[model samples]
Target: MKKARILMVVLFLLGICALLKCTTNTQPPAADGDEKTSRERGEFPDFGAMIPVAQFLKQYPGHKIFKLSQDYPKQLPGEDKIPAFFKMPFDDKSKWMDWLLAARDYCFEGMIDADFVAQDNKKRDWYHMPWLHYGPLASEGFSGLAKEAPISPYQLAPEQKHPGQVYALGFYNDFAGHTLYKMWNTSTDPDPFVTQGPKGGFPEGTVIFKFLYTELDSLDVPYLKNPYTRLAYITPTFKDSTNRIIKTMNLIQMDIMVKDKRADKYGTGWIFGNFCYNGNLNKGKTMKDRVANLVPVGIQFGNDPGYKTNWINPYPVVKTMINDTLKETFINASADLPPQHLGWGGRLDGPVDLNTASCMSCHATGEFPQIAALVPAQAFIGDTLANGSMKYLTQTDAPAWKKYYYNFKCGTAYDPKKATSTDFSLQVSLALEYYWQWKNTLMGGYYSHQYAGIQHMAIRGGIPFKQVKMIKKRGKKQKVDSLTQTQDGF
Candidate 1:
């Protein structure tokens, strides 16, 4: 009887050990000669690769990509359902690409009302429409004119030190539409900045796409003749009163920011992708066909220390062209085509001077401008000249640059939860600034009439006039200043 009990006890212990092993063996089996499983290797399988191109075409047949010139019908047929589609598995790159193409088609089509597009060019303008307009800096509240020349202080082209040539920006509605409404509804909530939550605060399925253009022609600066240099100084020139010389503005870059819980490991549950115009087109094609010309530079999913930096260059052809260049090609913008001078690690950045700014690094700085006060002054201002005529701000070896880079990394001092988190949304940061400006206006008891005129027009569609009036009243006493500070390195 004693022997039997001992054997039974041993058997029970073995059973417990087996159960523990089963629970612990979560990782997939490693392949031959491989030390780690697929998950351990930091390579989440590309479920997107399994999807065929034909499948994508079948789903989004119209291929009616968004064009800046054309005024698309507001609230397109399938706009509301986009958020649902955006919820599809984030692990697959192919699926994400297809979703992006489709989302671009649907969201862009529906964001603007078609009737608005048909109205009088002067009275019913896309810019005047509330759903789509420039940011606060270019808005009237700052006394900014719609067609005013781009200012150097706000320009991102550090090398050229020239402002945007033909700057036009607009936001799209998605799952986070309600959030946009709530934040902008100043009459109800005057202090929206303090109300915003931490980094990765945006609800899932939120998608914000920003369209930035640079003029290809250099009629303004006749001395800047080189195509590369011309792109660097993207200053738009104008004609007479009767007819403005609409210079060809190339769709230089498009940036997409998405809120995905799958990216939670990165501190901010967000993914960023940037596209560049490759200058290639089908025979007899034009800039209106932005879909074809705009090629994906790459996508950044995370910036965490443990989360491997996975950059997906969807187009192999473009990658080949860029990779073939010498190492110096990346450090020097003039060596390659302006568009080809992508960010560090081949991430897509346009002709705007952002050689040192990665999508994650730039966007990670998405916090209230007030947070800037807490940050060291050296963090904002980069290093001085080393050899070139332009300041050597791009040098990665400098101590200041290193600190700047480290601070922008995921889960760093700059991105801490309490006072500095903007959830990786530049829009959120901008909104906070706007809120601050509004509050200050109230404190001073006066505001810019010109800025109010522009603000009234932009928010007219989304915000109530009563609320707008309240906001304007607050700004009545304060003088509106140019929005000199920029987030996302733009």
Candidate 2:
């Protein structure tokens, strides 16, 4: 009996040991809900994604302008809906034709009607022009007019000092300012500047514009009438010695979008500074007469047919064009200067280098206008009652402009002047603007970070429609519209 009891004890101990081994050897489940072994599972999330048009429409109905533009007669008509002139077969009505002729006027009607600025402050009739700020400084008699002369690459003198400073002038504005933004470069390596604070963001500044007019000519729209002779001025915040900051100018374009699949990168629209080839009006080119002569140079981003974009020479981002000679010179010239020492608002590098235009002056980290890198600025050009008046107003009025001007603040409600730094401002600005215009409330703010940071998010392709047919096509099936749900007669 004693030997049998001992044998039972030994058997129980062995069984317990076996159970422990089984529990310890088991492995946790794979991430991404994969059941496959570690070797068979994919390594990372797929970044190469093409957002479908249907999905984009379903996700963002208001952004799907084509549906509204195409079927305007059938849809509800109001201030919120598509304007009749923009409708398909737009010339179908005479009253709408006159309205369509002033489409840009309609787009800006609220601003004119609001008169957010001076009633007499209208120095020039800039509102009537098709494209604003799209010409050279002195192309035509120092006005924003495009010079009859041909445009060539800028011949900048060598920098003799450390961190040179030059102000690009010609473009002007009133109480409110502009905010240009850029997407973080996802291709080469992560931008070291991106972070949680003001200092932690994409570098941005003024980049001079020096492109051949022949290039601009190639970008002409086929059926559309070209507005300006040439694109000459860029907007910047620089002041004269008297302590004025707005008088400063640069020859740079706002809202440049870059898209590259192979680079594993895409660019959000970015704005920068540059030199105007034309001299100032009185001292060089007078501010009033300078931009007034400006005309439509070319369209950078197209809203039709798959959303194609054309920049100078087909090069997307100017940062990518810096060659060895330019890089070598910039590195040597900027060696002694401390990074982020330029302060929150400092913008300028000494004389421009002929070999390369230093785009980083305004674009690299820590520039005040790097507002877009940290937050979206233009998004607010229409957010408030006054700003929205400037944005959507048709008939200009000064009293209205002032009433809405004070409400314009780049920062948050806590502090509109300056609150949270970095991408948050742009995000918040975009949120406030889109929410007010499209959604009309904070609860319904329709801004999306994904689309906000990626300029090409709205570009897409779809099936072609039949010319003579009366049927609405969905996938491979064609059905008569009257027979669809609305005709079900409940």
Candidate 3:
């Protein structure tokens, strides 16, 4: 009897163990060198069923030429060598439109494929590119503008209203990728102010595209039905274990900045363009046709002094949704929208209310330690209001309004002889700011102290500390201030 009881107990225990194993082993085992756990490498419900790039190309024959270019101009003098195919004259509006469409297709190609996985099967989709976010972590924050005000005084802008939910994915062409990698790799390095080395400035043929999306219900406003196509990728944020379909974030805006010496007369050798999605596309029924909905808001090649700054805005009147209500806004449509609630002359904005900044003005603020701030805290007295109300200073010849209007310059409009050039790269300025923030952290402070101690000892032994002048030729040197010096520039 005792032996029988023991055998039965053993059998029961084994059964329990088997049941536990079955329940616990819910996810697939990771392959070797696959540092990502199952949760980190989110499962794709229809893994193999994703639309392949080749198939997509076949379906949309017009996008056949949208492939990565092997040879692109990288430096000065080489700018002139850029092929006619890549160069669109400022006056040629049709050519610019066609080039932009093709460029968008080229950048988004292969975004749906699973083969392009980077960093532990973190699916690299069109929205989640490798070079953009830097890691697997999805951008965090509320879907739209934050309910509360920002903690930093400098962050007091319309764009700063949202902390993280407004996800942005950036892409660099072959010419710019080389430089991007170098800067990104050293992003965590102790020194924060180093903007240049052997590989710093982007090459002449470099092109950067930034796609900005706003989550549904982001603005607590009713969204237009079928405003944009939905993306295949699911949002990692959800209570249910099953994957929920995250609609392709409403395609608010797309920004394109290019480096070409032909634009050197503007000051930064860069041309900036902003495109806003027109939910009411005349011919867009399919996903491919939706690309046509992106109307060119304007292009800033230079911030000329006398003129109101020439630009092209194909659609001046647009239908928009705010706070769940439908509304119509009048844009300059001919020139870039003047500085409104956000972004300069409204060139740097999307559908959302953001900082008062302009594309070229904001980008031109890119510099090490970011000495010069771009956008002023308050709007100009004669500046156009967000509601499309203007004081008509342009017609009155008022000095104050005229002075405010002249501030609109393209990225290349700055005089290098008078001010230091950031080479038309915001990444350079951001890198330095990142370094400063890192050095101020507790761990950063400890590491910095240790390094400083070593340097002090070296100095006693005849080594000298590297010195940099904080002030320019005409002024006294000033102390290095906060790491957040460039926060308001955006």
Candidate 4:
């Protein structure tokens, strides 16, 4: 039988190499009520079936408090300092030629003037615009607009023309297909840990699009393997009396990229990168004339993926799915029965405090002056409160501000079993065993999440209803209806 046809052709090539190693990387489906809220019930503490990775290695046996080192029990003040500005190599152009020549004289000839406003209407005019931010590889003492300017109301001085502030000085490109989306793709095998960028050499900060007539016309221009780029060189130029340059703008460019994983076309997500201007030198086309200024329209799907699928979108896994639904109702009641009594840091029968917004709701980040961004609030750290009051806490209100905000109701919405009189299912099994060991130390562990879409490209920049209010009444004049139908041929 020819040795049984060589053992059935070596078992059909090892079953096509175990179905091509189980169809390479794929994951993104935990968000729809996250596995029925990590189920666990009974024992008055269904704290989402516990499983804090074997009780977080029996309570941090080798404890590693969010990396700073020296093992840390408490160390701040430069905590063993190390920044000569992150040492070197991000593609060192001689150690970033003095910060890219101070980002080209602090973003050469910059001009930024925008006001997204309306947290509650600080004025009303929603989206006025003028943009540019630190270009010419800034460093010359953080580039012009004196009184110290590293961006922030554009640090005044050219006679300080504050006028409702908003003057961002030059350069921050990201425009390719805009942001980026593609989730998955396969050639048959290839993904050893994913790495590509040569044939057309595009991924260096991503940009390559050849759409023209579908199937990419003949299939080309499709690079991008993990490109994250940011460049800003501006000059919003301030002025007065007779000097000049007072907004004599005409040179702005902002290109932000992401769009690259294409699943056929128009699918994956994230996009925002497009702009070009250069003509004003002294006003012939103003409005900061960069080809008659008018760029706006790029930003996609911020909320509505239901589960997930991975294209690298970690905004801290949406605050770990809202602190695992408030640690599954603070461990249902704090388990351990028969001879129980365990109850460690209980008190949150459901008012909110799934570990006080899990790590200050994204660590909120420093500097506050009413935040717009000059420091304070950057990727993690939410619930504010150092006297800035957004209020979030577990205990301690003694000094000036003491974290407080745990209203865990978990079902209609604010649920997290709340945290207070201690014991609430052992503080939600020690806050999901300290957030599944801090989401297994982010990315490097491949849990994934990073490509921030040009900080909200723009569909009005991250809208979740800040104020629509139109309660009706006032003068009531019900029904009239008319203007219907339309053309068929001019």
User: Residue-wise lDDT of candidate 4 within 1-490, one digit each (tens)?
Assistant: 9999999999999998887777643544445333221112111111111114565467536632111001111111232222222232212323332432222222222222211111122321111101111122111111111111111111111121231111121121122111110100121211211111122111222322100000110011111111111111123331121221222111222322222233112222222222222122222233323222212111121121132211211111111111122221111111110111101122111111112222111111111110111111111122333322222221122211111122211111111122111111111122222332334565346221212111111000111111101111211121111100000000
Model 1 lDDT, full chain set: 0.38
Question: CA lDDT, every prediction?
Answer: 0.38, 0.22, 0.38, 0.19
Give the clash count for each candidate: 21, 70, 22, 103
Which is superior by lDDT, 1 or 2?
Answer: 1
Candidate 2 residue lDDT tens string, 333-446: 122111111100111121222111122221221211222221111111211122111112111122322222111211112122322322222222322222233333435544
TM-score of each: 0.49, 0.20, 0.49, 0.17
Which should have the higher lDDT, number 1 or number 4? 1
Off by over 4 Å in 4: 1-94, 98-154, 158-164, 167-178, 181-490
Angstrom error of the Cα, residue 287, model 3: value is 6.1
Q: Which ten-residue region of model 1 has the weakest summed lDDT? A: 453-462
The residue-level lDDT of candidate 2 at 85 comes to 32
Against the true structure, what is every candidate's RMSD?
A: 22.5, 27.1, 16.2, 27.7
Regions more than 4 Å wrong, model 3: 1-84, 91-95, 109-165, 186-200, 216-224, 229-248, 282-292, 308-356, 380-422, 442-490
